[model samples]
Target: MQRLSENPNTLLALYRISQAASSANTPRDAYIVIIEELQRLYDPHAAAICLINPNTSLLEIDYALGYPPNLPELAIHPGKGISGRAAFNGEPILCNDVETDPRYVKLIEGVRSKIAAPMIAGGQIIGALNVDRDHVDGFTEDDLDNLVHIANEASRVLQSVWRKRQLVMQSSQLNALIEVGQSIVSKFEIQSLWQTVTEAAHQLTGAGLCTLQLYESKEKKVSLQTVFPENLEFLDMVGDIAVTESLAGSAIRTKRQVEFSNITTPDYRDLHDVPHDSEVTSCLSTPMIYEGKVIGIINVFTRERHRFANSERRLLQAFASLAAVAAQNAELYSRVFNSEERLRKSERLTTLGLLSAEIAHEIRNPLTVIKLLFSSLDLQYPESDPRNKDKQVIREKIDHLEEIVSKVLSFGKAPEGIFTHWDIDDLIADTCLLVRHKMGQLKIDLRHHASSRKARVNGNKGQLQQVLLNLIINATDAMPKGGILTITTKVEQIERRSVVALYIEDTGSGIPENLVARIFDSFLTGKAEGTGLGLSIVKRILRSHHGDISVTDTSEHGTTMRIELPFVR
Candidate 1:
């Protein structure tokens, strides 16, 4: 220890090496600097830094100086050679007589003596620093001591650099995650959502190709849904994998990440679901878990044969979570829209029944008057006359008409509604939630303005919800691009009657002038796919509740629908 401190030149060399390693931006750069410094100070024929590869736990040369071209290709197992022995023991070795040492594994010819010292960081042996000479017994105890000090200093700087880089990379990954999450939420269509996730995984992992597979519990299989680049030619060759087979299947089964170091080998040839291409080498599969169940699998492939790091595994899993969220949101979107459609159909049927009943009652009174007049005008005629047969036919048809009217009246009778006092603002807010995702996906903004005074309405909750949904859906359709949807509620006096006025407005292309007058007329629609019953049913519901709806404003800028219902205190 005294000898190490006494040499001014040795101290200067160590200081320079430490500075070089510290100034490097990456671990690879620091490795090069440390190896070059070792060559300059010791003047050895060859100097190299061989670190333990996390994947193989072997001493593999990371940086070297003055070694053969093939030196980089060699990986020595721990406790096998001088450097390996140093790393294995976590100590320094001064092998002056190579011929006498049984542990030495010959690599470069004519190299007789070598010195190895383990590079320990955080109380663990990471690798070893090695310097070789061409003659036997060429290195001394003092040389070995200097080498050990240099190795320790290099290890400290290297570890600091590694940690800094890791932190920076992790920060980048986190920001990417935030962006990807936002993108995932904005994609309502399942295919677009799957494509977004696939591309994100590919970009984040830097993989050659990324594939997204969705798990179908009913089918008990995982099918390839989408792929990054969208141009991978081997898609036709890939097949659906059962939950019990393949790398992706294993991930789903275990709910854990599964890795294959090399998929080109004969053992993996039977994995029909994995893309078999020469350019593709390694594969990593992670399951997308949602609500404690596996929803799908995300598989990433690397072009070069490589072992994935712990950080990479964590990132892939994070992406899996994002993918799961996208899947969940898409499913929810489908369900909401489907439910809205079903409700619309139900409301249509109810309104149609009420209309039929009203028409039937109007015809029933006149038919009874006709029947009474005909009975009063009873006339007798000869049995052979055609007029007698005609009278009989008229009587028969009249009776048949009366019977048909009575049946229609019975079938069209309105069912008693479940009416209650409900806050208009709360109902509107709740209804908005159902279409919020759709609005977001279309880039539409929604603004709701609740009345300062409580605007309560006495009506069927389901009917009112149906009304709001109908108007909102129509507004969304009118805006094919994207715009703002505004909902406002206020209490006002109309013709001395207290009423609640609800306004649903959209910044969309307004209703055409030709259709404005009869927008509420059944089967009158401007839209290509419109059933034309939405607004008609809306009008019927409002009328039944003694309310009214009108187009208060319309232009190319937007449209406003005002629904006025009698206010209940």
Candidate 2:
């Protein structure tokens, strides 16, 4: 190193570079100043400043002078060329004969000599300061020594800017984390919760897109839930990924965060087969965990191979934590609402049972008296007379009334029917026997079909029978002119659970559209003669037994009702 008194020009050059470094906004800008001074001092054919990328552990060209237009922005790894060797070895290299030197990789034509020195910071090489000449023996030992000292000064400036940037970024991260915390506590809907997380990540990192994926824990699969700026063309290619083979899955398995600077060329050998669109260049996936369990993953995507900063990682991790809690709370709220709905249905069943018993008792006494009087007068008329036929008709109507009264009496019984594992096919067969005769009277054809397999459901037999009976009665009423009535039973999967489905289809004029919605409401009737309590009571019974009924199909041609009961595995 030359003293300021011995070399006035060197002092002036140092002052200019130092002043520029102090005022520049970034390391790149400072490098521009430093390289300019080096060019004037050594009079080389080219000068370039390269910085080490911590993510890739390679030297990245930050700024260059006199380089050819065709030169790509190639990463310089350890021992690849002169610059790479200097940066990797943490030393200075001065080659007066470029063609003879093995470390020299040809760049500009006619360049015969070059000198490179490592930029060191915190006892490690961070980059290389490289200069090339067009003629042999163009540089001296003094020039190499001079560049090394200047490179050290440049490294100090880079370290300062890096530290300052980190401080600002960390501060921003803290604020973003606080916002995420607020959203977690307040939001409950699944869509809204994921939207908040993506929006927060986009804003925090200034990334163009952020994706949220949901994990189906039972199925052990992950699927893309939502993407920010929903207009990407790659949406069609997004598909479910198995937990064992995904970058997000690794994070979930380890319960940590994973990042990829270049997903097109992932570092992990296992990810070589992972198919991602070319538009996504860099990505980071963090597991959304709650209570030490992985819930899902929040992914941040960029269109370029960006070295994700520490602040970005921290912010995303914070988001994952908050998002996981929000998801958990939303699911818990859903389960709670479902439970409350069941409780309300149970309460409604109890009230209806009490009311039905009161009405049945009042109607039974008068019906009994009429039956006794009719029996006394039955032998008075001649067997061939029309009066005798009319008397028989009245007696037959009395018995139907008695049956209706008996059904009402049964309504007062427990809603949770005998809890037993019974074959649903057998139950349907027994109930069809009661309605088969009535269906024949109306000339309505009946068809029954069953699956080859048997599925048993646990429920009260009487309550389930009553439910089937009510639906059959409605089917007969719908087709007074005689249409086909079909009942089909099968075992299927619902929400990943085994279930038994009983389908009742009637080829009668479909229910009026206006009345279909309210058909299960108490006292809402389509017929002019009777109170509409049959279907309402059926709904209550099915619900009490942990089964449900829905109108699966309906039109002018017919109506189909489907009742599903959970089956034991």
Candidate 3:
């Protein structure tokens, strides 16, 4: 002690300790420098600084020097060792003979004397500066006083440095989180966004696996969208958990964060489809809350049992919030895409309507000239005369020409239905009569039945007749070899609303599977000689009368089409 007071090295050591404490920019650096200075002051063989880990309530060797290379990184609890005792009590410990000290846990081969001083700042002990010497009684009372003073001065510098480092790290983490949020929100595809989120979560948390589970409202189920490692067995295990049973589900149900340290426990294993393995030990789950409701869950898995700190939990929650917003945006974009497709189809139909009008007008004049020439021929000249058969042939050809002109004229004309109260059954029977000849040509049997007291629909008489005509003709054309055509009318109560349903069924070779979808589309035809405008006209007339038509059923044996019109009442 006497030699140390006058020694030139003593003053040098004091100066070095002061400079180190002032220059350190982080708590870890300050700890290293403080321990290093203590070793120099006492000329110890080894040194270390043990601090309290707030989360686990344990003491950890944060920094050390001159110790065995293979020493374990962890240390005894806060009150277990000489250093831990001093740190916990905020006092200094002096041991002249370490072998006799119960608190001393020796790690060095020749340690005999030891001193530990609490590093106190803002009236709290953060850690302790420890020192060890090679000889017994090497550290005197003076050594304890001097080391305590040094530790006291170093504590203030360490706290300031630590706070600065914390701020910087927090700022960097926030910026990284913001960038991830931007990337997720920019994606319009749900699957792609989910993949990005899971990948980012795995990287951010240093976890072995990551997964996203989306909630289905209709089924009240949750489905896994993406998982790391691409493990089918693990996925199947996770899939077995009911939407209301797993940790992820708990987070969603409670609208809170959930964490598990040991997934291998029986409680967790019971809920999981696959037994927990050694590869997965810890889990963190957070709910994706949007509009005050939980829509999904984001989960991360670690290989080792880990207590997730508050910072990590907060970070995961932030990610989940961003994901919720991105998912909503993606859904909105999908709806817009479908609406645009419908509008495009409407525009195409409008163009076809304009072109058909022009062609009908141009063909009218030539049709009129042919009709006048056929009328000028006389077939009364005789059956014996060769000109008689020639004249008869011209007359029949003129009639066929007139029929073609009439059909074309009907297509180009605007719908002019005589609006009146009429029995739909009588109208259907009349329309079926007009198509009976055509139906006979194909060997088809046409039948009609009314199942309601009022088969009355408020619409144009002629338009309804036209609709019935188109349907019977189409049914007849569908079965060229003859089949059954049945028409039925009924009053339906759907969703508590009264509606009239007109059903037309045919046994003709059911509409070709591929053409079934486009049967109502204008200019879509299945027959080589069809005008392709019949069904289109039927659909337009129905829409004009505030009605809708849809295919009820189609199979190899038959096809059924249903038309629904809201009753006037």
Candidate 4:
């Protein structure tokens, strides 16, 4: 103790080791610094730095010098050997006669003297530093005190490094969890979702393998869905596990996280569906619960025996929750998509029927005139005259055509509805109110210009409202980046007839020149997801009420849809 306190060189060595250990980036770096300093100061025959494995509770040499090649792999139990005993007892040991000391376990060929000191921090012994000399009684009491001081400094620095590493790991895990949550929520494909869940869990937890399994309530079984690394043959080897058996089943039944330190041990080996693969040594399982019911299970496996930390276990539980939400979203999306498809089919059939009736109505007017005019051209000729026979055939053909038109009109007869006078301005205002929320969400600005006088028109209120609503929604869709929508209504006179005109315009990219001419044609669209039937249906509804719609003006600045109805007298 006098030599260690008086010698300036000894003080300098201690300061240098402390600096080196404190500045190290990792525990391994600190270990190397401590072992190198011990070798330089004492010139011992053998020196080693060992740490206790939290999972195994064994003192394993992390850094060594001058020892046999296989000595680093030696596992020393606490209280079993000189170094292990020092660590277990939390004290320093100086033995001059190794052959007489029953606690000494020979690691090197001819070591007779040994000194060991425990490295302690936070009131816990972490490991020990050991040194050996070839001759008995070679080390002094002063040497034992110096080694203990060096061990203490190393322990303090190493603990600091471990805390910093843990903080960094926590930050990284948080970022990974956020990314996984977003990815799982946006995607709905079952296979793709399963792949993402397994890969993310494996990478985030630093596990060797990850497996995802879903619970089937009717079957009372949990079946493996996906595995990370994709090439692992566990899919073929593993089968559906009953809800009553296995670690995964236990988690589902308990609705909590379950872990095993050494899954290869006899206690877990006999469990059904246990992964018996040699590479898998430890396992952590978390149940996927949604709405208080377990939907699935997530399991992460480690290649070496490890006790899962609290952080890792919590991260797995979070991942399981995200997986459950994703599965439920996928199911809902499927049902909605199927329902939308069926609705579209029904709408198409209804439109076809309406168009058939409209065509028949147009043909009946001209057919009636032709039939009446032909009968008036009666000629007084004999039955053998060819002209008379030709007239007879023409009359018969016209009658047959009239019968066909009547059948078509009857098949798609429009129902009679009450028609009342409505001010165009009030109608447009009500329609805009319905879509005000949508417009606000899209950042659109609506500007309505009512007429100076009431432009009243007689029409079915419901059908007219449908026309205005369709036009408003279409205008909004055109201005995807949120532009201005202007609606104006006024009374006008065209060819000496009074009419009410309503113009709906949008400040959007103009319709393509190729599409403008056929804008109201059925099944013609400018949008990727458009059905191409909205404008066509709107035009038909307007025509049925003695009104019409047309694209009055179109340019790069925008498009204007004009609707004209006869003014009520």
TM per candidate: 0.78, 0.56, 0.61, 0.68
Tens digits of per-residue lDDT for model 2, 161-197: 7776677668777877787678665666778877777
For 1-569, candidate 4 gives per-residue lDDT tens digits of 56677866557668877786458778788777777788878889888888888889999888888876785469889998899999999989999999999999977688989999999989899999999989999798988988888888888888888887888788888898999888887666777888888888887888888888888888898888888867457776666877777568778778999887778878876566666764899899889899999888888889988998888888788888888988877766555445445545644775787688889999999999999888887655788889888877888999999999999988776554688988878888876665554566578998889998888999888778767767877787778899999989888999999999889899988888998889989878887877788788778878888889999888989999999999986
Q: Candidate 3, residues 32-114: lDDT per residue as tens digits?
A: 67776666677678777766665466777777777756544556678877888898888899998988989887666788888
Ranking by lDDT: 1, 4, 2, 3
lDDT of 2 at 260: 74
Inter-residue clash pairs, candidate 4: none
Error of 1 at 258 (Å): 4.3
The CA lDDT at 197 in model 2 is 79
Q: List the residue pairs that clash in candidate 1.
A: none
Clashes of each: 0, 2, 1, 0
Estimate the overall C-alpha local distance difference test score of candidate 4. Answer: 0.83
Candidate 3 achieves a global lDDT of 0.75
Q: Give the per-residue lDDT of model 1 (tens digit) for 191-251.
A: 8998899999988988998988888888898788887767555555565777666568788
Candidate 2 global TM-score = 0.56
TM-score of 3: 0.61
Q: Give the TM-score of candidate 4.
A: 0.68
Model 2: residues with Cα > 4 Å off, grouped in runs: 1-22, 39-45, 54-58, 68-77, 95-103, 109-114, 132-140, 173-187, 195-212, 227-248, 259-273, 277-283, 299-310, 339-569
